[model samples]
Target: MKSKERAIVSLLCATTICVSWRGFRSCSPPQDQRPCACERCLSKDDPCFMKRFNKSVEPFLSANYNLSEDDFNWWKRLQHEKGNFRTFRATVARLFLVIPLSPDVLEPSPDRCRTCAVVGNSVNLRRSHYGPLIDFHDIIIRMNAGVIKGFEADVGTRTTHRVMYPESSVDLDNTTHLVLAPFKILDLEWLTKALTTGFKGRSYAPVMVLNPAFIRYVHHTWLENKGTYPSTGFLALILALHMCDEVSVFGYGADSDGNWSHYWEKIRNKKFKTGGHPGNTEYKLIQELDQQQKLKFYTGF
Candidate 1:
């Protein structure tokens, strides 16, 4: 009788366990097993990023407008802490892909019919007369007021973005995206000032591409000795890699001839022969990157 009672209890426990498991499945099904929502179905069919991107760039599409509350809050937060924008990690505190970066807005969408040209501040491109070809591209990113008439032939008249420093002499406009290469406390001060009315004009909210992210990426690939600043041209190329599907590089240091002096400086009565920029090691590095077809360099450099 004792054995029989023990068997009965075991049978009852097994049956209860089976029922509880089925009930649990009914309550919390696996992702595949669960009934899908319409939103989930649509999400699987479409990229969530596209909708988010459309919402982000709506102002740019409409007109030169004020920053949104969400944009402001997002920028304000990243303005202090910080990724593609990350290519290294040195400290344990460092994280990658933390935030999508500069709000992940499509600069120019498919329907927008925009081609992009990233002009570097290399002295090698002085008086090259490549501006027309460059302007034909669609959106031109020029640094330090590198402009010429009839030059918008290839790239376009739209100086869509200007990568600048407080010390830079570049003239900015609505489309300008001030890229701060912050290294210290004072750097933050200057960036904040630009974002505000400190520049003696209607304040523009800059894209705030954290150089620290690229700084890390440089080290990730280059290791401890990532080479100084790795050339703004290199940074520009990396930017293209992340944000653009197709990108063209202009006024870069393809000058193995070591000739320095950009076309802009020549207009301002500066020496065209001045070798502007850091060590040649970075130049060689950029050349290698270009050779790898990471970016298309102007044939004439």
Candidate 2:
């Protein structure tokens, strides 16, 4: 009689477990299993970043004007504390005072066209006579220590945005946007300190850091997370796609002699090439993009 009663209790417990599991499954469905959303979709379907792009110069159909609250949160969540003194979340909390959560919005213009010029530091730009054409673009994105003081005639001087790392950072006026592309957590801290407390006894002079989510997306989706990170020029190109409706690339690829050199620097015997970066692959990708008619590519003389 005791054994029968014990078996009855065991059966009841089993029945309760099954019912509870069914309830749990009903309450919590798998989010990943669901279909992709239109705006949030970062895959091939989205017209903006489609690899097979073939369109003329027009406004970005669905440009993200500025980073949203969710984008800021993603930064905090994705930044991992790997063998660090302070956690990423903790550091971000302290750094929030100086850094703007979202970048300045690119206001819609109904009258004028929004054109962009992505100027690379290739030696082919020398004597290219692209200055007049470059200045015509509404937005000009220059990366790293891309100086215009000496080479203004070749590569226009009117700079709307400058993208750089901590080492390559430069002082900007109130008009030009200093876009900081952070590689590590320290980069973010440096920006905050440089603007607020002054880094290394000097100031980076108040800047706007790029959205971490955008960086991650470019690294994983576009770059396939291959090397240490994507080049700043490549990053700038992706950024142009987001902001400008019509984009033009100038001063990319090697010179006629098949040498990689910057227009600003003098030519050297040894060919200048990318180190720790897939330059060949990147070049092919850029060529493909141009062939697709998404943008115009001017191979400078």
Best by TM-score: 2
Residue runs of model 2 more than 4 Å from their true location after superposition? 1-86, 108-112, 198-206, 269-271
TM-score of 2: 0.69
Window of ten residues with lowest summed lDDT in model 1: 84-93
lDDT for each residue of candidate 2 in 46-118, tens digit (9 for 90 to 100): 4645743222322111122333445444444443424242454455566666655545646434333467899
Q: Which stretches of candidate 1 lie over 4 Å from their true place?
A: 1-104, 107-115, 145-156, 219-226, 254-257, 267-279
User: Whole-model lDDT for model 1 versus the true structure?
Assistant: 0.48
Best by lDDT: 2
Candidate 1, residues 73-122, lDDT tens digits: the string is 33334334342111112111121122123343455333343355888756
How does each model score on lDDT?
A: 0.48, 0.68
TM-score of each: 0.54, 0.69
